[model samples]
Target: MTQISIGVPVFNGAKSLDAVLECLRVQTFTDFEVIISDNGSTDGSKEIAAGFAARDSRFRLVEHAHNIGAKNNFLSLVEEANCDLFIWRADDDLCDPDFLAILKRHFDSNPELALAAPRVKFVHDDGSPNYEEDFQILSDKIRPLRIGDALMGASSSWIFGLWKRDALRHALEITLPTYPYVWGWDPLTLLPPLLDERVETDANALLIKKSISTARYRWQVPAREMWEMRRAFSRTCFIAFRQRDWTLAERVIVGVYVFRFANLRVYRFWKTVRAQMREWLGLKRRQRRSVEG
Candidate 1:
């Protein structure tokens, strides 16, 4: 068995999968396997993945006949990995050769760590690291407000992180089938780790990555998909609260709706238009801008 499994879940990713595969092929840490889960990709991803599998024993392919939902497809991918440590990477991203080498050593040194995440460096279209501003953004959120205080707020977390195999299984059990979250995987993955284990963050810019295509859970994804996600998000929050978490859960529920206030589609634009106009006119002090810009 490999020392770790890097779960790469892809969808119509032929355009960028090869770059990622090439990066993996040259990894200094060779004792790991790549679980390439293809979710009904109509593109050339199958052929690209097949080429890699033919040459490398570490590369394995799991094919889904139809576009199995992203969350379930992801679950299926992770379930097939044979290692205790699970590292998630988008198909279009690149990883530093030392990414796993450094992370695995930490696991070897401190066996109790259930999860860990490293500082992610956002890259421009040309692939240069956006080091100047990205780190600042990460530094701001690494210490988010206590979950309860942020209630009526929003709940979210970074995904390119390492997870202990067992921690993932526990989170899966809490999933609800409300038409696609399959168990609040997004919010579940985001918040549950904060409860069971302290997720470690590193300054090492090991996980080099970018999204080559729009995927559910990103801002540009469909609103229905997002609202569907919020259902799971809210449900997870309730579980977190009833399970005796004093602050994080309730606050997270509130946060998910509040942050997702517009996305929830609970309030009509015209109905809220008057209210929003009043707030806008009354408040000259507060403003929100697009963060990615």
Candidate 2:
């Protein structure tokens, strides 16, 4: 059996599919299997995945006739994994050749560590460098503090990290049904194992995340969307409360962390509101002055 399984979930990602597969083909760590699940991509994604599977015995392609939603596609990859160690690879993201090797070393050295990931470096689609994230490691010895640390500091990209298959499966079971939206899926799924087990981040290993320039800005999002995001955060907090294994004090500590996170979100929301109000007032004043002149 392979030592690690990398699950690649693809949906209409023909543009970068070949390049991503090439990256995997040349990984310094060769004892890993790549499972690519193409979710009914009308693009040439299926052909690209199949091409890799044909050329590389370690790479396998699973084609779905219908487009399963992105969440289900990701979960399906987890279910298909045969190895105890697993990592999710997005169709467009690229990682250093040694990414798997570095992460594998951490898991081998520390059997209790549930997740190990590299610090993320954001890049444009053209592969130009954007900013790198200063990701805080969530390895606190105190379990409650670990939960708090995950709540406040964990990056969503950590979802792509190498994880113990069972821990990841359990986390998905807790997160997916609780807060079913795609907006906060990463942190929610990442929270459970982080609460109970160790997580390590390697500054040396680099995962290049593609930053889309045309995506809507935070302030441009509608009020209803913002409210739903807040609701998602609250639901994530509820997941902590549902942990029957946690002590009351542990639950309370996580609750305090959640409260602080919520307060920060509210502060940002009001700040955006004030900025929009000022812009509107200035626009109205300009119209009045033009009419008087």
Candidate 3:
């Protein structure tokens, strides 16, 4: 059995898919499989994936007849994995050749580690720098983190990190139900801590996230549709807080964090309402002026 399985979920990602696969081809570690899930792309993504699969036995492609959305596509890849360790690789991201090799060593040494991730940086399509770094600088050496620290450090950036397959599957099962079609699954990262799986971090190892470009735009969900997602994130936080056995101090800290999230949501909702009212009043005034003219 392969030691690691990397799931690549793509939807019309022919542009950068080749580079993504090429990085894997040159990986220092060989015992890995790349599972690509195509979410009903009309572009040349099929040909690109098929070509790679034909060229390399390690690369396998699964095509969907219709668009199943990103969340399901990601889940499908996880379901396809048959390895001890797994990671979700976005089509636009890049990893150093030693990325898997380094992370694998950490997992091999630490049996309790549920997740392991390297440092991350965000770059543009042209390789120009965008965000300074993807994750907070927690430490320089590999170290185990408390559940709370790990949960706070997990910026959905860890979603792409190496994970124990069974542990990850279990976490997803508990957390996925909390989220709907498309919104904040940020709380899902808290699953490791919730499931009592330890998390490890390596500030030196690197994963490069290519920031979204004009050619790679994401589908924007409307504001009205996002309330459920926001609530889901808060719900996930509460789930983690309740599931884990923490000290009274930790509970208080987590409680404050959740309360802050609720206040922020309320503030955003109020702002949205005020903006809508202004727009409606302006429209009414324009209609009156037109009638008088």
lDDT of 3 by residue, 1-293 (tens): 78999999998888988999999889999999999999888888878999999999999999898887777888888889989899999888888999999989888899877788678888877898887444543444322234434444455577788889887877777667765543345345545443364666676668999775442112122334445555666676567557767677766765665545433522255554554565556533122111000
For each candidate, the alpha-carbon lDDT, in order, equals 0.61, 0.78, 0.70
Each model's TM-score? 0.69, 0.82, 0.82
For residues 216-272, could you state the per-residue lDDT of candidate 1 as single tens digits?
A: 223333334444555555555457545643467545554554344323323233433
lDDT of 1 at 132: 26
How does model 2 fare in lDDT?
Answer: 0.78
Residue 84's lDDT within candidate 3 is 89
Root-mean-square deviation of every model: 7.9, 7.1, 7.0
Clashing pairs for model 1 are: 147-248, 148-247, 148-248, 151-251, 152-254, 153-254, 153-255, 154-255, 175-183, 176-183
Model 3 CA lDDT for position 221: 28
Q: Largest lDDT belongs to which candidate?
A: 2
Write the number of the candidate with greater TM-score, choosing between 1 and 3: 3
